[model samples]
Target: MKTLLYIVLVLISFSVTAQKPVVNSAKLEEIKSYLKHFEDNDALLGSVSVFENDKELLNQSFGAIPASRTTKYQVGSISKMFTAVLIGQLVEEHKMDLNEPLATYFPKMPGASSIKLSNLLNHTSGLQNFVVKQDSLKYWLKKPVSQQAILDEIARQGVAFQPGDSISYSNSGYYLLTRILEQKYKKPYETILEERITRPFGLENTFSLNGKTEYEDTAISYEKKDNKWVKLEEFYFPNVQGVGDIISTLSDLNSFMSALFNNEILKEETLKRMLPKDDDWFGLGIMKAPFYNHIAYGHGGDTYGTHTVTSYHPESKLGITYVINGEGYPTNNFAIGLLSIIYDKDYSLPELTEYTPDKLYYDAYTGTYSSPELPIAITVYQKEGALMAQGEGQSPFTLTPKSKHTFAYLKAGIHITFDPDAETFLFKQGGQQFELKKK
Candidate 1:
C-alpha cells in the first residue's frame, strides 16, 4: 500500500474530472457474474462493495461462509486516509497547521524542526519507514510494541533525506501523525476516530484496533501453500495504529468513501487541497486510480496478508472498495477486470488455472539480475526441482510458473517475465515496473 494504484499496465489516462455516469441492468448482471467468478474460482478471497450516489449496487463476500460478509479485514495503509482527515479537521479547528513543524509536538524526533505536517501527509517527509527492512522487523513485529519504543525506533531509523527533498512512502510519518492527533485532541487515537469520523459518519462497522485478536465476523488473512489455504501472520495491531491498524468491512469502507465524496469529512476547498492539484502524484492521503478514461481518487492498503483498495469518482459519485485476504490471482488483475466491466469497456472474464510444474530447464533462468531502478540485485536459482528467487536482503521464495519463462510468487505480489534470449526480466510489484538484465 506504500504505492497505491501505480499500475503500469492499462493505466492509460490521468484526468480527475467528472465523466458521464454509465450504468445498466445488464452491467449489473455482468458485475454479479464478474464477482461470482472470483468466489467460485477462489481467485479473490475477501470482500467487495461498490456504491453509486450512496446506493449500494453490490455487497458480497467470497471464499467463505454466507456470514463472512460482515468480516472486518484490517485496512492497512488506507488508515492513512482517515488519519489525514483527522489532521484536516484539527487544522480547521486551529489545532494544527499544514506547514507547522513536527518539532512543535515531538521535539526529539529527527528533523522535527524541518518536517512539516504537509510533508508527512504527502509523503515528502523523508522519514525512514520504521516498519521497512522486514528482515529485521519480522523478528519482533509479531509481538507487542510499545508507543515509546516505537517513537525511539523512528528516531533511530532517522531521516533518509532532507524534509521535502523527495517522495518516499513512510509509515513512520503517519504513525507520528497519529500521535500528533492524540496530542492535539488529548485523547486516544481510537477515541478520536470514533468521535470525529466513525460515529459522525454512521460507519458502525469501522473500528481502530488495539489488542483484541479475536473479533466476531473478522476472518484471518491467508495464502495458499501445499495446495491448501494457510493463515498468514500480520503486524502487531497496536504498533501500526493510525497507520495500518484500522479494521472495517467493505460496507463500511463503501460508506466512508461515499461520505467523504459528499463533503461530510472536509469542506470542498479543504478536500481540493487533499486531491491531486495539477500533476501531483498524490494529494494529502489520496491517490488516483484509472479505469480507462475515468479517474477515481482514494487509497490502497496492505498488511502482511490482506490487501485493500478504496476510491470514489466525483463525477459519477461512484465508490468502490475491494479487500483481499488472499488470492489465486493477482488482486490487481481482478481489480482491472472488474473496473473494465463496470465502465462497459471490452473485457473478458479471467481464466483461473492452477499450474503443474513443468520440466523446462530452470537453469536457463538462474542468474543474478541488477536493475538500475532498484538498489538490490535479484538472484534467480533452482532449488529442489523448483525455480526460486531471492532479492538482496530478502528471503528466498519458490516461484510458481505461469508459463515456461514467466513466474510469480503471489504471496509477495511479485511477477517476473523472462527473456532468456536477451537475459532480462520485467519485475512488477505494488504497481511499479522495472526491467532488469541478467548479470
Candidate 2:
C-alpha cells in the first residue's frame, strides 16, 4: 500500500543519467518478457505502459482481468499530482499562495496559523494521516461522507507535530488541500479537475469515482484469499476524493505525466517547485522514486485491490506506469524488476510461488510480539480465513505464507520468520531485521 496509504506503498526514490537516454527493441523485448514471466505464473494482472518523447514503447495489458486499451483503474494517491497541479494553477493565476497560512483556507484547523499551504503541499504539515485512522475502523471508511465531515475528522485527529518540524505521509494534508481547491474555485475538486486538468489534457479515461457503480471499460479489483482472487469492495469514492481516489488507465496516466513534465500543464517554473528539493524525496504533489543512478519523478497509488505507479525521467521524456489489481507476485518487486531491465541494472524475475499455511499454524503465530529494538508491538491474529498482523497504531494486513512458519506482507515488503517453539519471530522491513519475542 504506501504513498500508495500510511500503509500505502512508498514510491522508492530513483536517480537518472547525465548521459543520453536509450530505448531499443531489445530492451522493450526484455521488459515484455519479464512481465510475461509474471503473467505466465498467474502472479500479476493489469497494464504496463512506457513512453519516450510521448511515443509508446510498450502498451500491453496482462492478466485475466479483460483490460482493454482504454480500461480505467484507480490510480490512488497519484490523484495528488492532479490536485497539486490545480493548486499550482491557482498560484499561477494569483488566486492562491503556497506560502499563505493554512488559516487563510481553514482558519480553525490545528496549527492553522503556523501551517502554510507549502507545509500541506510537501507533507511537512503536522496533520495526522486521517487514512491511518481508517485502519483502526474508527469511522465507516467505505461510507459516503460530506466535506464538512471529512474536515471534522481531520480536525479531530489534529496535528501530529508542529508545522515544518517533520514530514510524514498524511492524506489529511491533501484532503485539506482538495477542500481549498473546491473552496477557491467554488466547485468540487472533480469539476475543477475536468475544467483544469483532465479535459484540457484530453485524458478522456481519467476521472473520479463519481458515485457510479460501473464503467464499461474499467477493470475490477481483487484480493488473493487462500489461493483464489476475490473481488474487493472499493472504498466509497466520495469519502476518499482527495486522498486515495482517482481512476485512469495506464496510457492516460503516462500521457498526463508527459504533459506535466513537458509544461503542457503547470509552467516549467511551477513544476520545478513540485519536484523533490535538496535531499527530500517529496515535492508538492510529486515524489522521487529510485532506481540506481537515475531518478524517476512521479507517484505511486494503491486502493483496496488495485496497485499502481506512475513516473517519468523528466530529462529523458521517458515515462513508465503500471496498474495491477491482482497480484500473486509482489507489485513493488515486480516494478523494480521491470525498472532494472529497463535501465540495464542487476535484476531477477521473481520465482512466482504460492504458499498455503496450515490452518493449525495460524494459532501458533497469533500473539502480541514486542522487541526491544522497536517501539511498536505487533499483534498477530486470525482474520479473513488467513493470518494477519496489526501494529499498535497501524492497519491490519494479511500475511501470506512463504513456508509453514515464514510469512510476508508483500505489499509493505515485510517479512517475518516465526519460530513458534521459541515464541519469537524475526521481523524484517526496509532492510532492518530484528527478533521479536512473544509478549
Candidate 3:
C-alpha cells in the first residue's frame, strides 16, 4: 500500500508539471475552416492573427493574394489606437492636458469653447464624422485637406453635443487629434507615429501607407463573387488624416498591441488614464469593451475593400489583430468569437434549422416589407419549398425557424419577430420595427 501511494504521488507531480495551456489544434483547424467558409461566402481576402500569452497559435492568410501578411492593408479606423497611444505618450511627457478645451490649441472652431480634447478622443465631442457626410475619397484626393482644414471643418460645423455628454464615434475628432499633435509637436501625424509608437516598438513593417509608393509584400485588396474574386482599386483619404488613415500588417499590429499592454510604451498610470471608465468604454483614445473577465482595448477600421480590428486585454496579456479585404466583414464579432472559443465559453450561433412554413403563410409575408431604417423592404418568398427573406441592399439569405412564429436570418445575425395583429404583421430587427399588413 505504501509503495502504491508513493507511485501515485510521483505520477501526479509529473502530470502537474507537464500540463500547459494549449490552443486546441483541432479547434484551430475548425477556425481555419470558418475563415475559408467566410472567404467562400463573404468573398473575404485578408489575414488573421490570434495569440495567447504572446505565443501565436493561429496565423493564416485567407483568400486571394492582394491582401495577405506580405501585403499591407489600410487598417482604417484602427489607426485611432495609435493616435491614442501617441496622446498617452504625450500625456506621460506632461506635454498635453487631456481635459483642456480644443480652443486652447487651435482656437479657431465655431464653438471651440464647448469641445474638449478628452471629448474628441472619446468620440463624445458630438462632432460629425465628416467621412460619413462628405465624398471622403473624392474630396480628399482632389486636394488633400490639411490639419488646419480638418479643424476648420469641425469649427465650421460646430459641436454635435456639449462636452462629455455621450459617446458617438467621430472620425473628425481623431483628425482633430492629429491636428493638435501636429500643432503641439511641429511634425506631421506620420512622423509622430514613427517617432513615438512604431520606432520605439521596433515595428519595421508598420507605417502609414498614403499612396506615396506601392509597398512591397503588401496584400492586394479584392471583392469576392460567385466562387471567384474581384480586385478593388484602393483609394486614399488624407482628410481623415489620423482618424481613418493608416496601413499596417497583422503581425506588426500584434506587436504593437503586445508592447502596448506590456507597458513598453506608456507608463501604467498613463495607461490607466488612457483606458475607458466604468460603464463607459471610450478612453484617452482607445475603446474599452468587455470580454469575459477582462476588458479589451482596441479599435476597428473600415475602408474601401478593407476591414480590420486590433485589440488586447491587460489581464490576460493576449491581443489579436485581424484584417479582411471585405467591408463590414464582422471582424469584431469574429475576434470575440475566437476569444470565446479559446476560453471554452458557451458560444451559441444561430442555427439554420430545416424550417417549412405554410405556403400561404409564406405568401402572406412575401410582399415587399418596408422599413424606414432599410433602404428597401425585405422581400420574403417561397423558394424550393423553403421560405427566404431578401433584405434591401443586403445579401439574400434563408430564414430558419426558431419557432412557428419567429424566424432568424442567417449570416445577418438578426431575428424577425412577427407580431400578428389581425391582418397585419409587425417585423422587428434590432431596435427598428416595421408594420406590414397582409398584401
Candidate 4:
C-alpha cells in the first residue's frame, strides 16, 4: 500500500511542476492567437518571445515568414539599449565621464561646449530632433545618412534648449554617442558593439553591422496608412551606426534584458542610474514603469517600418519582448498587458465610460488649451450633448473622461492626464507626450 501511494504522489508532483508558466505548446498557441488578432486588427506584423529569469519561456513568429527563429528584425530604437551598454562600458573603463560636457567628446556640435554627456543620454540637452523636422518618410525610404551629416545638421541647428531643463526624445543624442565611441575606441561602432557588448554577452542573434538582410525567415514589416496595409521598404544602411540602427532576434533581446536586469552588464550603481525616476517614462536609455510591487525597466524601439519593446522586472526577474515589423503598433500597451496577466494583475488602460458630463458642469471644461511647443490651441466644448476637442486644423475629437479631470480621446487613442499641482493636463499620443494648460 505504501509503495503504491508513493508512486501516485510522484505522478501528481510531476504534473504540477510541468504546469509552471514556461513556453509550452499551449502557450505557443496562445501567442499565435495574439499574433493573429494583431494581424486582424492591422495592428502590426512581427515576432515575440517571453522569458522568466534566464530561461526562454516563449518564442513565436507571425505574418509572412518561416524559420523566423533565426530571422533578423530591425530592432529600431531597441538599439538604444546597446548604445547605453556601450556608454556604460566607456564609463567603466574610465574613458568617458557621463557627467562631463558633450563638448569633451565631439567638440564640434555647435553648443557642445555646454551640453553634458548625461544630458545627451537623458534627452535633456535641448537638441532639435533631426528626423521629425525633416522629410523623414522620404529620407528613410532612400537610404541612411552619414554620421557626419547627422552631427553637421545638429551643429547647424544649434541646441534647442538649455541642458538639464526638460525631457525631449532625440535620436540625434544617441547618434552623437556613436561619434564619441568611435573617437574613444579608435574603432568603428560595429566593432566596439561586437567586442564589448553582443559577443561578450553571448547574444548570438544580435548584429550591429549592416549588410544584405536575410529575410527568408524574417517577419515582413507593414504599416496601415490611410486605412490600407503598406509594405515597408528598407533604406540604405544608416551611418548613425551605434545609435538607432541594429538587427536582432527576440532571443537576443531577451538575453540582453536579462543581462541588464541581473547586473551582469553594469555595476549596481550604474544600473541604478538606468532605472526610471530620473523622469516619468525614460531613464538613461530604458523605459521604466511601475509594475505591481516591483519596478520594470526596458526600452521600446520604432524606426520607419518596425516597432519593438522589451521589458524585465527586477524583483521577479520576469521579462517580455514584443517585436513587430510594422511601425505604429501598440507594442508598449501590449507588453504592459502581458505583464499584468503574468503577474495576475490588471492594467488601467484608457477606456470609454457611458457616463456623460452633466450639462451644468460641461462649461467648466470648455476653453482653449495652450501649450508653448504645440502648433495649435485645443478648443474644448460640448457638442451634441457630449464634450469634444478640436485644434486649428484638426477635426473635432471626442473625449472620454475617466474622472473629473482625467480624459481620453477615444477616437484618437490618447490620454489626457490632469496634474493637480500644475492645474493642467498632459496629453500622450503614440509615444509623443506633451502638456496643456487651460487658456
Q: Please tell me which model should have the higher TM-score, number 1 or number 3.
A: 1
Per-candidate count of clashing residue pairs (backbone under 3 Å): 0, 19, 11, 0
- Estimated TM-score per prediction? 0.83, 0.83, 0.74, 0.69
Better of 1 and 4 by lDDT: 1
The per-residue C-alpha lDDT of model 2 at residue 328 equals 63
Tell me the alpha-carbon RMSD of every candidate.
4.6, 4.4, 10.9, 12.7
For residue 103, give model 4's deviation from the true position in Å: 1.8
Please give, for residues 240-287, the per-residue lDDT of candidate 2 as tens digits.
786678888899999999999999898989999889987788899888
Q: List the residue pairs that clash in candidate 4.
A: none
lDDT of each: 0.80, 0.81, 0.65, 0.67
Q: Write the per-residue lDDT of candidate 4 for residues 209-328, one digit (tens) a residue.
A: 455444344545676544355786654435545655687888888889898878899988888877668436667887775444445677766665666777776666767777766533
Candidate 1 backbone overlaps, count: 0
Off by over 4 Å in 4: 1-32, 39-43, 64-67, 134-141, 211-218, 224-230, 234-237, 291-294, 327-333, 346-439
- For 1-439, candidate 3 gives per-residue lDDT tens digits of 0000000000011222222224668778867876676555443567888777876777788764534455677777777788888887777788888878878976776557778788888878877655543443333433455555656566666666777777777777777788788888998787888888888788887776454656677655566432245676654556566777677878788888888777889887788777878867567777765554545677667666677777776666667777767532344455555555655555554232435554556655565666554456677776776667776676676666667657765334556755444544456654666665443
Q: What 10-residue stretch in candidate 1 is worst by lDDT?
A: 1-10
Better of 3 and 4 by TM-score: 3
Q: Which segments of candidate 2 are over 4 A away from where they belong?
A: 1-18, 134-139, 212-214, 353-439
